[model samples]
Target: MSAAGQTTVPFTVPSFAGEVSDAVVKVLDSGWVTTGPQTAAFEQDFADFLGAAHVVAVASCTTALELCLRAMDLPPGSAVLTPSLTFCGAINAILHAGHRPVLVDIDEDTLVPSPETVAAAAARTRPAAMVVQNQGGYPVDVAALTEAAGLDRTRVVEDAAHGPGAARDGAPVGSSSYAACFSFYATKNMPIGEGGAVATSDPDFADRVRAMRLHGMSKDSWKRYLPGGSWRYDVKSIGLKANMTDIQASIGRAQLAALPGWQRTRGELVARYDAALADLPGLVLPQRDLAGVQHAWHLYQVRVPDRDALIAELEAAGVATSVHFIPASHMTSYRAVLGEEECGRVPVTDRVAEELLSLPLYPGLSPDGQDRVVTALTGALRARS
Candidate 1:
């Protein structure tokens, strides 16, 4: 049973069956499955795609965020400004790096922190660094945000978990920041199951992340286990086990090659959604193609009335949906950190958290599937009204 009377439309389905499968099998047969040649190749390919100076593949985006913050070498308990309306990983990374997380509110339309808000928070907190997220794969104005934070580009990190092929002002997302972290989770825009990368133009920062992704060893295991490798190595600093496996990199290489086509398909799907749902009452569509930037169209989120009831209605109709976030300020752990007064500061975040709904949007999502989602949503909204 489905919204259109058959086959449920899923929230997300990774588009990897042919070439991706072949690539993974090839890696399995190669016998070197750790952070070896495949991982190196994937990193190089991704860097070339972004025109970035360096890129380091890691175990997950969470690890990449932590790695970037640790590379900053900030003092313990230093303030780090981040958005309240974002995935938990962003705030968690700030706390994990021995920094205090200062939650900022987001813009109502874009669901991203505005430059003015960031500037105001930076002035109040005098934060050592700022973590700006490209919420739902929409590229944020990093240059403006950096200027607002009153810090150089080096102190800004782009949490690009929803951005892989996204660009801003004729440049890739990672090209103009201190570091941009990408996710290749099962449901993210780029799917390699569980992997991520940190892209940066700074050679020194890239070097630090490369070393820190492993065990802070002077030489990586790939170098130590090679034919002419030496067993002798030196430890520099404490690090984490966040290196990406060659198997994951193998799949990522295939996905990276196909990213352009996949992005095109997503854009087409988004266009269809926009055209069909534009006039629906009590529903606000997500922002699209602001100024000169390209939106990655990773999530087709909409703000609707009776959000929970609409989700249930769609679920009964066989269309799976989800919420992008719960607003970090509302979470118990973040509430404890942000206290009561600060928690009530994010009015927009609080409202949007209750209204936002992510519909089905992915490369594999068929037009018929999208139509079903739209129909179900329309019916739900009308019924609620």
Candidate 2:
């Protein structure tokens, strides 16, 4: 909410500093503006940031996930266990990679499949691999989850789309997952308008992702188009076109420099939200303050009784709210592919989807605006009571 005229608070805002625009302008001015040096720099910088052995920049997190899955070389239609409460992209990526998705149930509190849930699901499905998401920017303990599921570490793929800056088990995300995907969507912690990446320690996996992202080419255009470079390139295998552009990478590079401060701001804001909403009746605050973990605070979600009614009330009070997700199994498109039998009874995911409500969370959201949101939310809840 704004202090003047009290504008409605939006659920998310894409915060940007001046450097992003400056970087974009620089890229535009440079002769090369596609997937060239800027993209390469961003990939290297991201790898350094996460302490990963390799990183491949891509067009979107979904694309990165697909490419990673494709590199798995699993038997066609292999079962890939994934959370039902996660973004549809993870499930879609599995299907796109010629695999079957087995939707795993989530922990009601964490809004992610717990080790126990994953273990149970894995036992039932005997999955070939799993997509573990860092739900709401809170990193998952993939090592523990993998152990609980009795799966090899190499078979786990991380859907870290919500969190690029989050840390778990004494290491940053993308540091250890066999492969981890990240997003730089407009509303994400690292806003790049629309971009994503794949980070991994496996050199072969990185090479495969790089080749597949641009038509399985032996040489990327950047290498082929530079002065004294040959136009000829070899297509070694079937692949998709999902390369990140230099303009996006330029902005991403600038954003990377600004990320730490932005994350700190998010943490501070989340702290206020935790303290303020603690007293609100019938409200379930999101997972917070895990030991040895740094939450990215991507979405400050709260589960409220009468979620629909509260949203309407909040709307009337000039406050905006949105849900993190509707279970992928609940959506029609996935239903057509998964069918009822395949995606059966993600009981916790189904129940929690109704109550999960994402509140206003962004670097630009002022304390007063947050206060206004809180006041409106409190009023709305009180009215319903």
Candidate 3:
């Protein structure tokens, strides 16, 4: 129902405005707003939701990745295998953890690193760990990837930043991995303005993450302030300041509660998009969900010829769009580490990067807005042809 002059449709918008506002105000009134009871409650609730044994809330997914890597205690300069076609945070975490990142190419169809690719990379680099990412909320085959990488679950970390509600082979993403990291950024599946968590089944690993998240203190501030609590504590080891505040946790809890319904809405929107755009020319849709797996539908990306032109056309028609990622190898910082020749190894990643386009798909997007997007996109493709 929209026309070229109609109001613009945003790429994404956080849901439950009223609930988030109320949660924030309640936390403001509680006085104890730092990483306190609310954060603990959120951590427990999130762990329960993911069917994980333990969850440690942090300030961001990047920090959660760093925490997970640090917990592993890998040797400095050890190689960590990761996909080049993913968010920069994944690679940044590897570099920041004092490890050398071994970039791998993605499968053309699934847009994720394949088991074969991982195995090949592992064979070449003898990577100490494999950071598997669930790009765009599509759950990767973790078991197969781990087997191919010749690494046990203990050496594999799931970058589930886009995969909070996703499942693989009838198990939730966090449940199947040794450790899974999630994000609650403003635009993530669960919007908390800024927060993340590390979920793990190992109690010892969980304890280490908990300690490392808060200055490596013997006890966190919440525990130290309790009745009969000791006034003194020991700094067990050097740690990062990545604790999640109660305010963010409160918002995260509210968002978590509303997530199921929002996810349903997202699924419905994706179905609509598939139906509307299936036959469009010079376009490649995202892969369909495999049997027994649930996609979180965080991003509705497609491969199209003249991707930039389509984006410009959509913008002129008042529809907002985005790009999910630019390959890590394409970045200047990574280019210095991975020489141009090495970066060119990911042919699929480079090709996909040039053609990928993220359309507007969110809980609040209306059917009419989607129709307008489809119309604009089809028009642009036809015009080019």
Candidate 4:
């Protein structure tokens, strides 16, 4: 018995009040809001927080990815191996940088590409780079991928969009990767409304990324504004305008300040959801495998039978839901590029597309809200049964 015209429980939302508001007020009072001291502090603090050697903040993850690709200066039409089950931005970044995206399938449960798949794709294409995604905050087997690709020929560009506090094995996400991109989009665990960063251990690569992120300028505006700073700067190359502003960084700084506590709450909430939904029929919980790895828990997506109808039922009962993605090849534009034969080859990603569903999971998601979600899901599953 699915009800009609039901209320909506938003899938994800930023719950910021105290520190975020305070930071914003201070930024307003200071009157130097566009990429100033706060932005620099946030960038430095974020790099320190993640234990990465360099961090360059950008307007969005797409920008961050694009800048990194451009910084690499791969030959035109160079292929970059990436999971097919990812946001279009990943693919777009490839095209924007005058390269081709070599889409690959993902593991069934993890929803991330396997190193074996990466190797097979690389062998087929001799890729210049591999963009691995930490799908749903589940860390990919980076070590395995590195071993397969070797150090010289393959460069890894990690789309750590869902991995802020996430880890692989014992290493924190973005600690020392070839190049890692993180998103602070409004829906992410650490929302800055619209901002992202690229992290890397290679100082030279980081410097290139910095140059490309802000009009290819020789120096950032902060350099010009600091004491004994010069006003003149040179434009080294043609770059996009994709710098993070202090206004957004103010919120990011606050969010970064509270990330650990937020992660703990998310973990607890996921455990609660797991315990409640464990035995429910027609539902498959997301999997976790790394023994010592930490998950940021950015999303708590699950798979279910007849996902569309279940989503309707959940909405009818005041629980919101979302799909992680519709496979990239399914889109009309990419369909032409990959062709039907190639698209059908990604069996794992194709299967998950029919059933993936994201539940409401955020720091301020109340216990009562979670209980309502579980109850609604239980009822929906029973009704479907």
lDDT of 2 at 119: 84
The global C-alpha lDDT for each of the candidates, from Candidate 1 onward, is 0.89, 0.88, 0.89, 0.85
Q: Between 2 and 4, whose TM-score is larger?
A: 2
Better of 1 and 4 by lDDT: 1
Instruction: Please write out the lDDT profile of model 2 over residues 93-175, one tens digit for every residue.
Output: 99999999888888887788888888888887779988899999988889888887787888889999998779986799998
Compute each candidate's TM-score over C-alphas: 0.97, 0.96, 0.97, 0.95
RMSD of each: 1.5, 1.9, 1.7, 2.0
Error (Å) of candidate 3 at residue 350 is 0.7
Q: lDDT value for candidate 1?
A: 0.89
Candidate 4 lands at a TM-score of 0.95
- Candidate 3 stretches with Cα past 4 Å from truth are 1-4
lDDT comparing candidate 2 with the true structure: 0.88
lDDT of 3 by residue, 102-189 (tens): 9888898888999888877888778899898998999999888999889878999999999988998778889746889999988888
Model 4, residue 55: C-alpha shift (Å) = 0.8
Model 3 accuracy (lDDT, Cα): 0.89
Candidate with better lDDT, 2 vs 3: 3
**Once superposed on the true structure, which residue ranges of model 2 sit more than 4 Å away at CA?**
1-5
